[model samples]
Target: MNILKKVILIDDDQINNFVCESIIKNERFAEEVQSFEWAENALDYLKNTAVQQPEAFPDLIFLDINMPGMDGWSFIEEYKQIPEEVTKNCCLFMLSSAVDRKDIISAKSLKEVKDFFSKPLSPEILSFIKEEFICS
Candidate 1:
């Protein structure tokens, strides 16, 4: 079963968002890609959306670690406000350039984040995502 479908991209970096969105779309990995420049807006979207219907909602989320405010870390903390269904079925990956071991450890601690990948995202990363989350 193809698990990649509607996806949300939350990153303050415009280039990162553009590149990832382009890659995801060009590869037909996600049918829809919604982007947010900050985690706060992304959170607000999640908070208002009905994710219980997994087939109709976003299948995954790509969150960025470094942002002006409400970074990926902060967003994860506030993600508790979102419905449990949203957290259960959908996948969330931490896409960042941070090579810091501490950051890696921190991301691993978050139950919502399925994988921590360093950017810029390539075909291999995309494939891994598909194999791990989409096909699993």
Candidate 2:
């Protein structure tokens, strides 16, 4: 079964968001792609919608590590507080340009974060995620 129906992109960088959104849409990886420049807004959206319509939650979330407000780390922390019904079925991936070893280790340690990827997510990575996480 195809598990990617809706996807949420939380990155403050517009260029990154544009590129990622373009790729996700062009490849038909997800039926819907919602890009947010602020992680806080994304969180609020999920918080409000997940309860009112649990199925409206995105199947996948691509989060950026650094932002002016509510960085990815902060987002993850806040994400944990959201209801389980909103987050239980979805996968979260850290998409960042930072290559710090400490950052990598930190991301891997988080149960909420499924994986980490360098900037400009590739189609191959998405395919693998779909096969390994979604299809299974």
Best by lDDT: 2
Check candidate 2 and list the clashing pairs. none
Model 1 residue 92 distance off true place after TM-score fit, in angstroms: 0.5
Task: Give the lDDT of residue 2 in candidate 1.
Answer: 30
lDDT of 1: 0.83
- lDDT by residue for model 1 over 2-71, one digit each (tens)? 3476889988889888999898888788878889997888887787676544446578888888999888
User: Tens-digit lDDT track for model 2 on 19-116?
Assistant: 99888887789888999999999999988877788888889999999898899999999999988867889999999998999999999899999999
Give me the runs in candidate 1 sitting further than 4 Å from their true place: 1-3, 51-55
TM-score of each: 0.90, 0.95
> What value does the lDDT take at residue 119 in candidate 2?
86
Cα lDDT listed for each candidate: 0.83, 0.89
Error of 1 at 120 (Å): 0.6
